[model samples]
Target: MNNIKIKKNFSPKTYLHKYVYDDIRPIIKKKRKKVKSCDFKIVEPENYKNIVCINYNVNQLKQMCKRYKLKVSGNKSELMYRIYNFLKYSYYCIKIQKNYRGYLYRQYEKFKGPGYKNTKLCCNKTDFLLFEEIKNLPKKQLFTYKDKDGFIYGFDICSLWNLIYLNKETKNPYNRNQFPEDMLYKIKRIVHIGNIYNYDINIEVDKSDLDILSNKKKIELKTLEIFQKIDKFGHITNISWFLNLSKIKLFSFLRELIDIWNYRAQITMETKKNIFPPSGSPFNNINFMILRHKKIEYIQEKMLRLINRLITYGKNEEYCKLGALYILGALTMVNNNAANALPWLYDSFMIVS
Candidate 1:
């Protein structure tokens, strides 16, 4: 038997050059640069094909094929190709269909009678009456009424108020009238009577009493009145009246309002899903067992504005700074932008530190 001998000589540099530099180096340096750049431009169809082919497992590709009713009996590459073609063809078909429908609609509109062309034809007259009634009603009565039907009426008061407010704010009458009455009425109401403090109006706050009331107490009083008026009526036609109040008073009122809002939110989250709290729940007064997103958003906006104002013009620099940080931390629970909030946070921190 002839013995065969193989020479073994291993060099770290040679090994590294071949395996690390040649094979693995490019991958190490390779990165998804677009992600770091935060490039969110619409993805190209070709790029989608590559993503599906490279990242998807065989079963996922097969599942997608089944979902789109395409043939599933192919290797990964073939499956990917089929999926790409199907998506492309489906997209084009949808585009063409939409374009054709739009064209036909335009032609119909161009040839139709004046009455048919009027978008107001689709507007619900009853909803319009409700909107007008809501707008015309006393602000004090908008939110406070009990509906005979047990179903809370005028819940869309907030939306209607917003539309009206927006129209007036922008000086655009056309936009105000453009909405269908039903659509306008469907907008969520913002003010909740249950959240407002109850104060005896007959027991007036004299100047001396006002001087003695703590900031929190003053806020409770003002917010109580504001919410009462909102509940009684569907809208606040002249917020300028409230704005005329001292800035400190307004700021204190907003701070208290935010605290009340947070408490309500906690109660809302703790309540059983779809199961209304006992008739005794504080929410029952608002006729809402669950707090709506629109209302929450409105409160959040107010809190953000109040916090900003406190940071800008508050007397107690330390408190304002700490409050800004506190508000930023609290709002993160509600999924607000912490990065954008950092400026106020830093400003407050610098002022105090």
Candidate 2:
């Protein structure tokens, strides 16, 4: 009877498990520390050198082209040439697609995905009294684009904000005749987060509920009051009254802001280990091919910071100097000037090694 009692006491419910001591480990989440720019040093070029065509085999080149959905049939040089441009394009077009922290996998996600801030569209609901959500919309939301002429059509088409319009069947929900001449806008609404996906827009007659022209700007302030919430980054996509060209033009302008924001390498992104955080600017990256023959400084006013290391030699400047020269050589190779660029790259490798 004592043995039975001892066994019952030793059961899982009563006994301690090994997991209590063995499995539980405190997760040490290392916070990112900001590295100062003065600490930047020349490092190995191996990380970026892999991009050069000379590093890859013919089969690898063909595989890369295939992955990018490009035409894979070509000579080794041709394959390398095509892959080079595509890689450059992919790098420069940062916002187009990616799964990394600052990227979108699908091109369409630029509109649907979150992290986009637009004052007029998302935060300012009072700007338009029209029903936004499908639950509020009388009909289902369709993906479509409309023109200034007030036509409802889409290309293979369709996210229309179903604004109630006065037609033969339906009466004006907010009588248009009573609306001031300056208040009524036959504007086209592009239902997007930041960028235009599907190359389509939803055009309809948008009505303004302003009692007078002077109170037009009050809608934004009133929107915050009504919701009891303020937009996080309304200024990110807000346009001044001077930029009020046309609705379509305004949409184009908004999309431009998205590109500018994404391509800009963020300052805070750099941890203590890195000072020059942004790899390179979009301007320099895209123009490197054409600037192969030109001097680095002649390429752009905002040239690579590493380029200065070539002139300002320091004790730890080997990494910076190597990177600058390696980039110049890489850019030269992309322009089909391998004969001239090869020597510099080889010398860079020898020096760095």
Candidate 3:
């Protein structure tokens, strides 16, 4: 297999150009915008005006292709040929083959199109995994910065490390910045979490989050401690992580994420209008607390009604499962209805198909 080298020193403008040409141009085309361009803003994930992608890291993508006897020969013709061969070889179902063929063509087109500016897409989860892998790998020969955590940071830890490496060897760093949108989404999620869990993990000045990541020994120990605490609580084990959690099984994770956010944002997640007392506040007013709790109850009930309607007569199974889970989630948070939601949530889990 041919391998691409990753360069250490790249002009920031040139670096940005590579990404626009290599990644963005193929998917989106726009009038060439200046460096301080206002052409592309990262698209919000909630907006469904464009394509939706399921992601696994580049390594995983390669592995899957290999498993199916497919190859990603750098050239588009080769890639198309391989995709066509795979379509013919794997499935007799005409519909499935057509879908695969169509998907491949669109992906290929996006990979090869002219760069657009000012628009962002949904983050690709696979890209985050790939970025993590690149960050862990040895630094390429270049200027390296050490943080307060005593870990080195360098350009080797890019979101599109593979593309960078390929660009270096080919002397064509065109697709360098076409970071999968899902990776950006993860950053958003993490930032949101950080904003909420801001007090939980302190970033030492001169020590970035990447620094905390560098020491495997310390990270492992801390992770183990968190797992132990979760084990003791049992409640957290029931909570799902949004990224890793299945779409149908997202309610609990969404609920927890929102709750955590609420706690961080100093408000109730369900009743968005309500605010909680600041942490460690000396003021403990019972009447106010009662009123807030009642308001939350009302909101939860409203969500419950919506959820129940979607689940019982939902047109799609996935939507039904989502609704059921959310309904159960609403009940779980309230003081009284938590018990009632359990069996329903459990039943919904069984029906997920």
Tell me the whole-model lDDT of each prediction, alpha carbons only: 0.37, 0.32, 0.33
Residue 120, candidate 2: alpha-carbon lDDT: 22
lDDT string for model 2 (1-353, tens) is 44422444465423433212111112212342332445432222222223341345566656666677768898865665555545554554553443442342143333221212222222222223332432233211222222233332221112113323232212111111222121112112223422233543434433443233223333332322221211121111121221222333323322332233233212232220132224422223443345456542333222322233221332334433433333333333223333243454434323232
TM-score of 2: 0.23
Misplaced by over 4 Å in model 3 are: 1-143, 148-151, 154-240, 255-353
Kindly indicate the candidate among 2 and 3 with the higher lDDT.
3
Kindly indicate the candidate among 1 and 2 with the higher lDDT. Answer: 1
lDDT tens digits by residue: candidate 1, 1-353 = 97744335758645533443322222222232222224333223434434342445567667777777768998976676666655655566788987876665454333222223232332221122123343343332233121232222231233335435443332112112133333322222212221232311121224464344334333333443333333232222222223333444334344433553345224243332212222212222231223233343333345334444433332344434433334343333232243244444324322232
What order do you get sorting by TM-score, best first?
A: 2, 1, 3
Model 3: per-residue Cα lDDT over 28-128, one tens digit each: 32332222223323222232122113222334334435655656445433333333334432334566767766665454333321211111211211122
- Give RMSD (Å) of candidate 3 vs. truth: 28.7
Quote the positional error of residue 22 for candidate 1 in Å: 33
**Candidate 2: residue 58 lDDT (0-100):** 60
Residue 109 in candidate 3 has what lDDT?
A: 30
